[model samples]
Target: MEPDQVLSVTELTREIREVLQGHIGTVWVEGEISNHRLQGSGHQYFTLKDAGSQLSCVMFRGARSGVRLSDGAQVQVHGEISVYEPRGQYQMVVKQVQMKGQGSLQARFEALKRKLHEEGLFDQDYKQDIPKYPRVVALVTSPTGAAIQDMLNILTRRAPWIHVLVFPVRVQGQGVEKETIRALEMLNRAEAHGLPVPDTIVIGRGGGSIEDLWAYNEESLARAIFASQIPVISAVGHEIDFTIADFVADLRAPTPSAAAELLAPDVTELKRHFESLSRRLGGQVMTLLDRHEQTLDFIARGALKTAPAYQLQTAEQAVDDLEDNLKVAAKEQLRGLGDLIQERQQIIVEHHPRIMLMEAAHRLENQAQQLQQKISHKLERLADQVTSRAQLMKHLGPESILARGFSYTTDAQGNVIRDAADVEPGQTLVTRLQQGQVTSTAV
Candidate 1:
């Protein structure tokens, strides 16, 4: 171990390996995986790298963790630091591997997605319909980014008529969600904010990592997009990226340029459409005018123009026929009136006053006899009813009750004493029997 002792290449590598294993030992490292390779022998080799440095790592067949090992995967590895003696290189002998920072962000994304979905924010019923032709469009994006430039170019090229309102906002970093949300609010109540109301609002940003695009995934931003009166088009990141804003927005465009293409109708295509319509209209008008001109030509060359005297003679004959037909119709009408008058006279004779008076007299005589019979019967029935009522009254009279031996007692004032409590012990009393009245006084 002395400085004078010479060491072979193998010995030096073995010594270095020992030093790394004993000193660095087993430790955990987090980085993005790159140049990942899975050997046919079931061993995996990869490089773990960050911004400044890279470390070679290898996981043997036996230590193969079930976690997916792929390039660009952000992962944390647990292993012992060791040097490969044969290659004279130091590397980590990885024992375990798992996802790192991106995994937690993904988990948060999924959880927020579930919460908003359960709240009906992602429901199609709540999604506003994007106008087919937006007159005014508000772009909420970073003015300095490639996204805004791409959108403006597309909007200007496709629909030059569209009024573009650019409300610059931070599309990334902390508090970006609040800025995006504020832009949406201003665009929704644009008139109140003294800004022209936009028919559509486009929230867009260039492609980035999930962390960079995390602002669009914010719950508040998603809710703001859901609450927006103006339809929102979410164009965050690439086509593969999905955020909560994409799910809650009225429409999801794959990119910022795609959102512009959707909002702005191509001027050339619209012009072609209008030109086709104009051609069709013009053809129809020409066809109608030609038809009317043909009719006029036929009239100009017809018999009415070429033979005026013959036409006039035919008109005189037609008038003569009409006069004769009117004569016949008038004679028939007079005959009908004469028959109607005769029928009326016959009806009047049948209904003469003398005949009606005789019939009335006969009916009156018969009615008089019936009236006398009804009056006699009524008087008899009334007499029977009176006799029965009189008998009933006699049976219920007070004289009949006195003859039945019922008696009554009264106080000196001649008031009937029903209850004994109503009379005084020393007061005068009169007892009325069926035949006589008895008077008594206190002793």
Candidate 2:
């Protein structure tokens, strides 16, 4: 007889798996990736290592969607760490993986930026050209900071003649969006009131962490920049930094100094261009003067120099003829304009509705007078009928009947009677006139 085995191999494997799974469920493991390889089946196999130890990790095809895993990439994985019975090796089956804390945020930021960029939020066609010679430039940033100082320095160096207007506002932290939006509104109001409008707006701060530069990520600030009538330049954070405002702005510069450079022309280049144009103009003028000198030399040597008086006389007669023609034309034009005005006036008078309005007013007055007469007649008739009815009512009044020495009598049945026979011998009867009532035993 063989020794009795309580469970089969399959059962034992399942039992061991249950125990291992129960003992070690999900855990967060932080490590650096090594030997990362994507399989033909699209699964990822890698070893996660800390300074002292390492564990083999497998990210299945399903869980690896939209995930980019590479060698030497630091990652924190959440999943079950179990022993694989087949290979008898311990490994981690990853459920989710992301770059360690701030790296994870950066990954999400990159993802969002890629998505928005693919949607054409960062298209060059949407970018507006910065004003070449802006009269006023509005700076939206912290009132007191190095960013402002840097921007001011660069602007003064580049465009010292252009006005650098400051709409002092908070660049980061809580309520920054509200204050920034209010600053934009104030600029709009200034424009509405005909104050010098900003030609281009500069909104940014210096380099910092994501949290430190979150104000530019606000949707309100992004929409404000998009809706601005003036062009906007977003220079948020360092060269590697980006925000929604940067994507939506008409232009984005890598730094505040870079933004200043883009906003104004280079003074040296402008001076060079001006000098070149001035030299060209001088050359052209010299060429034209030489030609004129040649012409004068020919004319002095020709016959026209001796006939100056006849030329003067002919020029004077032409001037007089031109003056007379101008006078006659002016008078004719004035007369034509007057006739047109008179014709328009006659048409307006013929089309005027004032005459019809007067007729309507007269008719309204007549109707009102007729209504008044009818209302008065109805009131007089009503008054006469009321007086006649009053007299008739007075004649039928009980007091008038009582004044004629008449009285009304009622028995126990409450029936009014004029004869004593109407009541029985023991019944009580009450008599009523306008003045009083008297009760008596029936006779």
How many clashes (backbone N, Cα, C below 3 Å) per candidate?
0, 0
**What's model 2's overall lDDT?**
0.82
Report how far residue 284 has shifted in candidate 2, in Å: 1.4
lDDT of 2 by residue, 291-386 (tens): 999999988986569888887898899999999999999999999999999999999887679977888899999999999999999999999999
Looking at candidate 2, the ten consecutive residues that score lowest on lDDT are 60-69
What's the CA RMSD of model 2 in angstroms? Answer: 17.2
Candidate 2's displacement at residue 190, Å, is 2.3
Q: List the residue pairs that clash in candidate 1.
A: none
User: What local distance difference test score does each model get?
Assistant: 0.91, 0.82
